[model samples]
Each structure stands twice: as structure tokens, then as C-alpha cells.
Target chain A: MTEVVAREIIYCDICSFPPEYCEFGGTFKRCKDWLQANHLQLFEKLYSDDALAKATSTLSIEKEQQISRDLEKKQAKEEAKMERELQKKLASKIIIKRIERNRRKHVISISGLEVCNIDMKKLAKTFASKFATGASVTKNAEKKEEILVQGDVSDEAKEYIENLLQEKGLDEVKVEQIDDKKKKPKPTAP
Target chain B: MFKKFTKEDIHSRSNIKSSVQRGLKSKFLEQFPKLEPAIDNVIPKKSQVILIKCEDKISLYYVENEVVLFQHFDDLVPSLRTVHKYPDCFPKVQVDRGAIKFVMSGANVMCPGLTSAGAKLPEESLPKDSVVTIYAEGKENALAIGKLTMSTDDIKSINKGIGIELLHYLGDGLWKLVE
Candidate 1:
């Protein structure tokens, strides 16, 4: 059986050598030096900065300025869009409320703090120690994990969270006060 | 169980000598005779093997772009983990849904968990102390790798006690090495 071998041909203008064998001759540097010594005119024409500038002179100054302005506008628009998205994300309000469990018993429920870049367990511990009450990280009825602090500490917790956010440089965090007591309306007299 | 490795350490460790690599390949093959064909596929020729010794007597084997295998003091041979990239490169034992959490949390594989209703085992029984990969039921990849405490035949005969001693599992230090 006869074997057929297929070979690929690659040519470099400066080196005038096959691409595979070009490395053996120490890249195009050797070829450039040879060209500089033997073919001065051609070397000067090919390697000169003036030739490069002339080759790229097709675009007028006005066209170049317009292209740059367009690119800058596009980049500015992208940056603005990214900033808006970041604001939207950070604007997710951390909702704090006081939930009445029974007569004279209340618990402060803090939600949406999970979205913030803070440890939930450590935050719970801090709340527990700061308020001298039992605080725990538990999932609400909606299966959303939130921090629950014993007693009506919404106002205190809200201030603390805001300060914590500010200290962490998360000034964009918005705290929303939600009163769970007002959620259920009293039945009208019939 | 792990020490921080610098960029220089990684470079020096990865450039293992050819003779040493060959010895490692042979040792690995001898330990798992079933992986003879797939050995070259997993650790290909000219592939660099990096052995990083950690604080807890565990050796991390970084093969090319992936963390392929790990060895512990109690382990007679190196075992493959999920981070190895190539699934089914080694022998596998699928555990039940209830056992997935424990396995991922680095708990020893109990016989009851493996013999549960939904669990699956290989038709060909593996010998005791053999390196085996543990896969979760309904999952496509291996979750942990361990050494079988008892032979597959004995495991089928009995229903209690630890069946596999976990060496490496998901979220273990070795799993986080590549990251």
C-alpha cells in the first residue's frame, strides 16, 4: 500500500523561511539582521516607523476622533448601566419588624440581611449580646432565612445594622421598617 | 490539615522527575489493577504530577490542571475524588440519598447506608481495603473516595457497621486545594 503525506506550507515575508524551520534560525531576528546588512533599502522601507504611519493614514483625523468618541460613549454607557445594576442590587432593603407572638410577648424579625455581605451567625450573636436577648438565624414561613431577635428591638436593631453597614462601607443598604402589627386589619363592626 | 502553598512551591513540586513519576504510575496501577487501561487516560504521558505534603499527614496529588488523588496515613493506597474531573476512571459505589450529606461532610460510610433501598453496588465484588469512589444516588459524579473496610461479599452478607472508611470527601481540605 502506498502512503500519501500531506504537508502544510507557511511563509513569513521577513524571514523568507518555512514556519516550521524558522525557529531553528533563531526566529525572524536573524533574518532581520541579514536583511539590514544585505538589503538596506528594502529593510528601511519595511521596518521604518514612517512606513507604518503612512500605511495607517487612511483614516482622517476627524474620523479617528469620531471613532474614539463613539468608543468612549459606549464605555460610559456600559459603566452607567453597571452602576445602576449595582445600585439596584444594593438597594434591596433589609426589612426589620416586631412580631407579636402572644400577649406581652414580642420578637424582632430582621429579613433581607442575608443579601448583605455579612456572616448571619456572627450577626445573630452580636444582636443577642448587644440587646441581652435570645437571637437566632431561622427560616421564615416563606423559607427565607432571617435573623430573629427576642423582644421589640426593631429600632435598636435597625440603627445597629445601619451603623454596621456604614462601617463596612455598604452605604447603599436601605433599611425598611415594617410593622407586622399593622399587617392584619381589625374586622369592621357589622 | 493543609498548609498554604506559594506559586514557587507549586512550580517546583509539579516538575517531578520522569523516573519518580514512572514509579508513582506503577505504584498506582499495582494498587488498583482494575484501572490499568484508564490509568494513562487519567494521568497521561508527559503529564506533571505535583505532590504537596500538608500538615495533617495527607499528601495532595495535583495532576495537570486538576487535583486527581490524595493519600492519608491510614490509607494503604491513594484514592480519587470528585475533583479528579474524570468520572468513572475508578471503581464506584453509589450510596443512598440519606448518606449523601454524611459522605459529603466527611463521615465514614456505614453498611446500612450503602445497603439501603435505593443504594447500588458493583456486580463484581471488590476486596477489603480496596480504594473505591463513593457516588451519590441520582448524581452523575463521585462525591467521596474511601477504602473499603470490608470486602463487597462480606458487606452483602452483613448489614451493620462501617463498610468504607472515608479518606477524602467533598468540602475536605484536599477538595479545596485546586481552588
Candidate 2:
């Protein structure tokens, strides 16, 4: 008991559960394939022909069939949900807007990042240090969360966002840049 | 409790003093004495412990970005990741294969799941509201954590209704949060 050994459990890359518990996860098929490809020995030990037969519960065959059928339905629904989310990600675009704060100063506000799945606060922190300027996450007039960077770094911000999306395998995602100018008052002639 | 937890839900995070860390470790050990030997390994002496306050009164103790435990009320319950590491340290109950999917989907543990053949209630019946690590049939790792709504003995006799209120489960929001 004094040894204090902590168990090292291997988790499935797809579902993030220990391999033994992947059957209960929504992405069991992918998890199983990953386990099979990465840890063939463990995969065989857990999911091989006889292992699967023995792993079956004491429940009646009909009940087991019903459970498997229910699981298949759930898995299909999960797949459809993920498909819709991916489509949404692909269809959406990232917008970097340079808003004129004053005659000489400008601030960049990046929005439409709902698809990237990156943390806004963390990205803002990175932008703050990377550009050596004030950066923060704030809600825009549209009520969507946007990263507001002080100073005009619209192109740089766009490149940064594009690179971020690239890292997430979303290279096809569009990073749109735009400029916003405030209307100026004209002197009235008496 | 962490079914819908996310990073945005966190309100504040502050590192605790070493003395407080020692106290937290001791308090955790006191609750689960079976963890006496592995306590130091899990919560290393020099490791930083962060107290993260989140929405809805949930407070999590982060040991190097890994949330070792959390508290919603008086009792401090270990996260499932911690439970998986030292599963034997906590009192345990098993849910039958039939209930595995439901439990994975964050459902409460019903009496039938605990009373069924593939399932097991500990020999020494635990009291109401005691934290229990939930294992599933033929599974090597603990799949969930729950508090007994009814005593183990009562669950065996009553054989109906919810036996355990599930707090955290594999693949739930909290599980994905740290990962």
C-alpha cells in the first residue's frame, strides 16, 4: 500500500474514454477503429470475436437486440448532429473589421468566429501579447462575441485568425476584412 | 453537477497557498481513507493548486489544469478523471450493462440498475448521500460518480426509484472541459 502507484489508463482518442468503456460512447465505431489501429493487441483483447461474445450481458437476446438497435439510432442521430455542426462551420466566415475610433486612431473588431471553436479570451490574450497592444473580448452591437483589438491590426488579425482556423483543419473557412468609418459633422455656413 | 459546465461558466480562479493545499489534501484523505497511500502522489507537495469558482456555486480545485475535485455544496467530490486514476480509493457501486447508455447520457442511477444481476451494491451498505464511484459491467474504469439518494440496503430492498444522483460521467461537459 505504501507504493502509491497510480493506474495509467489509456483513453480513446475519438471519444476520450478508456478503451473498455467506448461501447457506451456515441462515437464507438470511430473509437474502436482508432483503438484497433493504434493498440491492436488491446483492441483484440477487448473487441475480438470471442471477447465480444463473452462481453455480452446476461440479458435475453431480444433485449440485447433492442438495446443495440437503440444504440444504433442514437449513433445515427449523433452523426447527423455532427454533420449539421460541420456544415454550419463551413458555411460561416470570420469577419475582421477596422473601425475608425478617431481621425488618427483605429481599432479592429473580429467577429463571426462561432465556427472556429477557439477560446475568445485566450485568443485575445495571445493577440494582446503578440501585437503588444490592448486586446479584449466584448459583445458587439449584434450581440455576438467579438475580439476587440486596440489599434489598427485588421490585416494582421485576419492572418492570425486564418492561421488559427488552419490549425483546426478549417482552412476553407473565410476570414473577411472590412472597414467602418464614423460620419463626421460639417461646419454650417451662416 | 457538471453536466453543462464549460470554461465560460468559470467566474474566478486563484492559486491556493501551500498550507491550504496541505489542508485540502488532508481533508480529501479524511473523507476517503483508502486514498492514504496515493494522496501525496496525486496532489504532489510542490504542485500548485488553483481554486476555480464557477457559476451556480460550483467550486473546482485544479491541480495543474486537471480538475482533481470540485464542490457544489459541503462535500468535495472527486472528478471522474481522478476517480479513474485511483478507483479503489472510493466506495463503489456498479450499474448493469442495460443502464450504461443511460448513465453515459447523464441519467440518474435507478434502483434496478444497481439491484440487477450484473450490478452490485457494496457489502457494507453505504449511507444516504455518500459519494460512490460507478463502474459498469465488464468495464475496467469507473464510468461515473454519484451520491446515493437512498442507502445501499434500501436500494436493494426497495428495488425502484432513483438510487444514486449522478454528478459527473464520462464524455459529459466537465469531462470535455479539462481534456
In candidate 1, what are the lDDT values of residues B1-179, reduced to their tens digit?
22233222333244567788788778776776655666776577878887766554656666767566656764434433422344544678988755665565568999987877657888999999888888765544566778899998888889789999987664455544443
Query: Which regions in candidate 1 have their CA more than 4 angstroms from the true location?
Result: A1-190, B1-14, B73-84
Find the 10 residues in a row with the least total lDDT in model 2 chain B.
B170-179
Task: Give lDDT: candidate 1, residue A4.
Answer: 22
Kept native contacts, fraction for each prediction:
0.00, 0.72
lDDT of 2 by residue, A1-190 (tens): 6756778888899988999887767777898889999999999899878877776757778878888899988888887888898888898888888899998899998899878777788989999999999999999898889999999988888877877888999988898988899778787887
What's the CA error at residue A46 for candidate 2, in Å? Answer: 1.4
How many clashes show up in model 2? Answer: 0
lDDT of 2 by residue, B1-179 (tens): 77787878989999999999998998888888899988887888889999999999989899977999998787789998888888888998888888998998899999999988889889998999988999988887899999999999999899999999999999888899853
Report every candidate's CA lDDT: 0.66, 0.88
Q: Residue B47 deviation, candidate 2, in Å?
A: 0.8
